[model samples]
Target: MFLAQSFVFSLLAITGLALPSNEGVKHNNMARSTKYAPKEPPLTTPWTDKVGTKPWPEYPRPLLQRSDWKNLNGIWKYQNASDLNAVDSPPFGKDLAQEVLIPSCIESGLSGIQTDWGLYSWFSTSFDVSSEWKNDKVLLNFGAVDYEATVFVNGQKAGFHRGGYYRFALDVTEHVKFDQSNELLVFVHDPTDDGDYVIPIGKQTLRPSHIFYTPCSGIWQSVWLEAAPTNYITQLDLDANMDGQVNVTVHSSANGTSAQAKVTVHKDGKTVATHEGPTNKPFQFTVSSPKLWSPDSPNLYNVTVSLDKDEVESYIGFRTISRGVIDGVERPLLNGEFIFMFGTLDQGYWPDGLYTPPNHEAMVYDLKVLKDLGFNMVRKHIKVETDLFYRACDEIGLLVIQDMPSLRPLQSVLPDAKQQAEFARQLDVLVNQFKSYPSIAIWVIYNEGWGQITDTYPEFELTDRVRQLDPTRLVDSTTGWVDHGAGDFSDNHHYANPQCGTPFYSTASSPYDPSRIGFQGEFGGIGNNVSIEHLWNNQAAIDTINQTYEIDTTIEAWNYRSHLLLGELEDQIRLFACSGGVWTQTTDVEGEVNGLITYDRRVSRVDEKQWKADIQALYDAAAARSSNSTRDSL
Candidate 1:
């Protein structure tokens, strides 16, 4: 009886039609007739138009590559539920009234349906499995979905995932028909600062203000389908270090225990090393005279792991991030040498795409521009970016200090057991998922005490667990306030105060512990709303400048003040002997106008050549200080 029902459903779906339900709503399975046109945003990049019908066509997962895959990042039917309770059932065969671009959030202008807030939304699309993939298992992957998501393949529940910033996959091989069209339906519920449950929401808020911006409600990253053999590599954990030692562990989906993996390491198209090892076991290989990965020389070694019938390609870079005592002062070290991590606080938000960048080129442009400006590192502030962003960093040699998104404090129903457990689980998933990226040097567990429970939050315990999970990288327990001094760096955040001779000042009166490296986590928030045409909202910018900075000044005056603050910050860094500092931001977000670059990305507030030279001078001064201190100690 069940087989007959499924067969009838498949036949109806394949015919590009659906039966009318008892509710008198006619269901249409035909392709959407509505054309996609992104809503006119306040600002857009050159690559905005390049995000055609099929956006983010590039393979989403670079670390784990396969020749056979399909990008499901195109037009999809969508329906906004009136409330959370209205999303009780999946709209299996119902025709959605609206169309939206996949990957871009419903709130983003790039999604075409830029509604104010969508707490509950449904998205449906149809895809056909290739004939060649008939013998292989089909995996449906979502880069990320805000809050909670329930997926259905051909009206059958496939999987459910909760987390706004982590990737999730559902094996829909059995649920999908190989020769017929398969209907994919996703129900998303994201209560951004409106829910009773606590989830990691970062700086997203429905009510946008000075610091917090608009919420990314639903699917904000790429969705795709991948074909894999039954005995395929599910994951590859590569641990490559500066000592020329490489450990490869392959996690597989094989039911039998007899599968062995042949691993090959390549450098510059030449095979450097190979090792055959059993699946699910760690195996070792060595590369002699390894070219260490650094900001100046970002060398990556290509790797391929082949099982009996499944093979996957990946890449790894050899580097180590640690803290070392240099001339009796602790400092951040890359590959056993002190390297100043001059960086910017990069909140990954776009005017058009919100949490998602318009396209791959737009994403690369930000990192490339930072690199060209002589900045070696970036603090990915409060948001986990798509894998492509990290891949670009790896290739471009920009160090990343990845921050875990914080939960809303006053809004969320926190201090409960369930919310706390969810936070911990999501944190674990985040660490395990992004541990393979060599560009990620530090894992910031908490930021500014946003969601921390002062007395009972277990900050130290959480920090220890993150360290245990990935001992290769550093773990920062607290980035700003409520520091338990539990992690590698005693980090702090301070904005520029023009009243002081040194605009940048640390809140801590006493010196930081000599055991832990002192770090200026955030500073230099100098408002430069220079380009009037590129402003997201003119009045908002004016209000922000007035309320936050309390200054009514001209563009030239603000820019001059910015340069003066930066000069003072350089002196402060030298005086404090801190490891590194991050300027408040890279680009202006929604209302907050204090950015080095304009929100539109078309205008640079500072002269690029002069900024680069100034940044290089900071690096030179830091290097000179290290050398002089060592000489004096000798």
Candidate 2:
């Protein structure tokens, strides 16, 4: 029987649904330990104080949202595991001697237990199933768990998940008792860079120095509980464009023969479009004169999908990112117009939280500051951030060049079959997971030859797969490496200054592919320590700051170099007709002091007015050159 939405709670009470009982489940009677306290960091953000008992209380997944959910992101019992065999025996119903904060990595200062616990660790907490959710399926959702995680509920092994950068969930309805406290335990194993296996560790390393950073092990994202109907909406694939046509695909857990889907799109609280169809089927609908999304005007429409009794809310922006001939040269186009993608290499890291941000505001603040400084884009350098970070970009109208986290040690030899399969699986996940975000303009496959298979075949294959999976966005096969001559962008990297004539590729001469757009993947390190007091206390980082190409000890010298470098970059776009470029970094990270912003984000190393003006000149130069070309063609 179909129950009305308003009477769902009342009807569930009298439904007489069979609920799990804790008949044989043992209960822990020991008192909770109070040993957990956030370790003091060398640098702290304003949001540090706000991260009290509960951090990241907001819903983790903004793309697919539910109104009723439980945030399990607070204090949790933790203990170090002696060996890998610990997964066989979880300390069920037993009190752990130590505690740590949820979502933060064990190596982070915010996690309380900042000591690295090697390969294995265990986490335990308890949550209650609401009586209103009696007939619903209780989903234990994890935003992300580093490396691998084994989950248990009520002493029963629920499920296991691998891959540190992707989200996963387990249906715990069978093990959870309704209207009662239920024990939930998770065991995590992260080898990081020390393991023999070739995993996508990005920039994490056991020994933190230079570009590699401290490893963020264990659960580094939110843990939550969501109640859903037995037959629910699993996923939504939306393909929106500026021409007012939207292709919608709704995936449901139920059989499509009987299930029905209703989609409604709203603009400014008014219904703009609606469609009714069957589940797991692709359908098309159109909006009247859609407002396109871009860095200048970031417009989004709220969407609601209903599948029988289950409903979810999400939002989408209409935009098209592609390469087109502009001024007789190929250039990146946003909404069919040439726009210079002036950006920064954004390493999404925080001193207090490590892989995770101190809070959502702190994450948004970084992007917001970039936008304020006239940067329209950010290349998320080799790090897959939580959904909140991308959602912030979607709302703030900042373009994102998302890089696939690569394996370590810069592989020159071919990977084994097992390693290749794992890399492909993670790459697939990275592409499919973030494809719905309109702000993501490009997908960067490999960076600077790290973990590259040393052959063009595998690189071409991976790039082809990403293109097939998401044909809407452009793909960058390899950035700053042996330019496999694949994907849409012929990208390259240089330091301290802009290289206009030909990009410096590591393997061979820079291939001038007329089919691909030219992009400066990285340039302009231009280091300046704005404040020594706020600098990272690492002596190696302090001593090595002057070793870079352009290390300015004073503000005046830094600003002068900044203008000169930006002027050269402007010429790269105007004189050489380069499409876009990414500056070295958004903020200084640990031992790498080459950032426009300091490591702690407390001070800006550049002269703000000059920096903003210089960036604006790059766009103006591109516009002027494009205009001249168009006039000449006529």
Looking at candidate 1, what is the lDDT of residue 2? 17
RMSD per model, one decimal: 7.5, 9.8
At residue 250, candidate 2 shows an lDDT of: 80
lDDT of each: 0.79, 0.81
lDDT (C-alpha) at residue 583 in model 2 = 94
Best by TM-score: 2
lDDT of 2 by residue, 201-289 (tens): 88988877777777888889999999899988777788788888887878877754556788899999999999887788778888889
Runs in model 2 deviating more than 4 A are 1-34, 255-258, 412-414, 500-511, 530-532, 540-547, 628-634
Judge candidate 2 against the unseen true structure and give its global Cα lDDT, from 0 to 1: 0.81
Q: Each model's TM-score, in the order given?
A: 0.91, 0.92
Q: Candidate 1 at 217: error in angstroms?
A: 1.7
Which pairs clash (backbone N, Cα, C closer than 3 Å) in model 2? none
